[model samples]
Target: MDKVEVVVAHAERATLRVGDVFLKVDADRTRLDAEVEAMSLAPVPTPRILWRKPTVLALAALAGTTLGRLGGPSTGSPAAWAAAGAAMRKLHDAPLPPRQGRAGRSVVALTAELDAECEALVTNGVLPADLVTRNRRVAEAALRPWTPAFTHGDLQIAHVFLDGDEVTGVIDWSEAGQGDALYDLATFTLGHEEHLDDVLAGYGADIDRDVIQAWWSLRSLLAVRWLAEHGFDPFAPGCEVDVLRSRM
Candidate 1:
């Protein structure tokens, strides 16, 4: 939305939406060869050799500046942090829609999937199997008291949008689903630790520590697998492989 405003105000502004970028897995030699053998000539998403790239790059740079001003650790001023904290608290407290009640998903089932993905990562040399298993067990213990609520599956800094000191919008709805609310909060805290305590505190008894930690660990582990499966790239824009690596 903010980008739309900037473009409208300018004499002319180029723009490139995220769908233009190909998923890393899709672009790999193996996948391309598979496509050729299948003899499918379906159109594939590709970067446009036009002003779109430059426009997207400019927008990204501006978005980074906004994030730094609002969420970065460098401000070092209590008032700024407090204001940002208040905004985050408001977001956490907002009334979310009821969970969609999807079938074939449960705490145990999801946890098992997370475990298998962790094992895959270890096999690929990105993580240690033993350590991941230990963490997986800890997460399972935490899920014992699980309760479902609306969750934004991807709530990192990249998914949040701010206008001045206020949150303007949130992007990426692919992972949104019914789950422990703490999962959403944990994802929110990944890169923006400065806002964690205040935001979670605002959530009150809606979620608890164990659930939050479990979500954090599981989400981090899932992130690693996602990168590996997608050939160390995000299917969507905004999140990069390095960010997922840091979480792992």
Candidate 2:
């Protein structure tokens, strides 16, 4: 029998791997259903649904390694990064899903959430006020209006898989929906600024650099407290804290 490996576990959900199958268990069925629906709607490659029962959904693993991790070095070549960008562009150009995604929240609502989270971070002493304030200023650029695209709400580097320079698969689709396209770009390039040019090359458009950078600040600032509370190290070398520091 294959040994079960825990992929990710938190209060909200968990994923377990048994051989080539990944079992996603979630308390929120809506999220899981959305994930299934999004994967079906996405133009990019996704894991095959092996089975599903109640809170657990089984998926056949994809056939490639990831692009990289947040605090680690990227093992993928520039071509691979570009391929990821191209894949993302395709996803963004696809038909909008039925439901709005995480990044699709109204600017007013997002602002209120960000403000509340910022206060909690400062009040809790999770981060220095100056850092928070500075990043908040930087984050303001992303608060304006945007044309909605079919966005993968969480397109972090690790979620993209590559076989050499070919993008084989993209995973974790619960947050996928119509949203600001720039958010996906920023999320992918966060903490890995060196590959921005490579990604932009395959993205094949003249996007606003400022908006992408603004998303980086907003994403890092909003992610810090949740990450810390969730048993993650936001201050790790080359992680979210370092990304914030680089902006100063």
Candidate 3:
């Protein structure tokens, strides 16, 4: 029998893998529901849902490996990266989902949330005041209005799978819905800036480079505290902290 592998676990939820199957266990049924709904709505390739219970959703594994991971080097060629970007563009062009996703927060709401999180960062000494302030200023550009699209709310590099230059599947749909398309681009290339050009090449749009960079800073600033509290090391090399310092 294949051993049960723990994919990821935190306060909110956990995922376990048993050979060909993956089990997502979330206490929040709504989140699980949202994930199921988004997977159904997404036009891009997504995992096959084998079954679902109230607290757990079973999924069949995809054939290809992920594009890469945060804080890690990507072995994917430029073509593979570009393929992922093209897939993203296809999803973005699809009809918007019914609900606003994580990337869909209003400017005022996002500003307030980032402000509070920034205060906590400085107050708690999680990040230097200057680092926080500089990034905050840069983050302001992302607070402007954006046309919403169907986004894979958490389009982390790890979520995109590729078989050579073709995209195989995208996993993790809990945060998917209508949101800023730039935010999705920003999140996919957060720690992997070198691949942004390649991704945008395949996305085939007149993207605003500055706005994507702004989202990088804002997203990093917002993630540091939460990641730290959740047993994740945002300060790790090539991670969120490093992304912020690069803006300096």
Number of the predicted model whose TM-score against the real structure is largest: 3
Pairwise TM-score winner, candidates 1 and 3: 3
TM-score of 1: 0.55
TM-score of each: 0.55, 0.98, 0.99
Residues 43-135, candidate 3: write the lDDT tens digits: 888999999999999999998898779999877899999999999999999999998999999999999999999999999988999999999
Clashing pairs in 2: none
TM-score of structure candidate 3: 0.99
lDDT, candidate 2, residue 54? 77
Per-prediction CA RMSD (Å)? 12.0, 0.8, 0.6
Model 3: colliding residue pairs = none
Q: Highest lDDT among the candidates is held by which one?
A: 3
Q: On residues 73-175, what C-alpha lDDT tens digit does candidate 2 reach at each position? A: 9888888889998998999989889989988989999999889988998999988899889988989999999989999899999899889999888989989
Error of 3 at 2 (Å): 0.3
Model 1 lDDT, full chain set: 0.45
What are the lDDT scores of the predictions, listed in order? Answer: 0.45, 0.92, 0.94
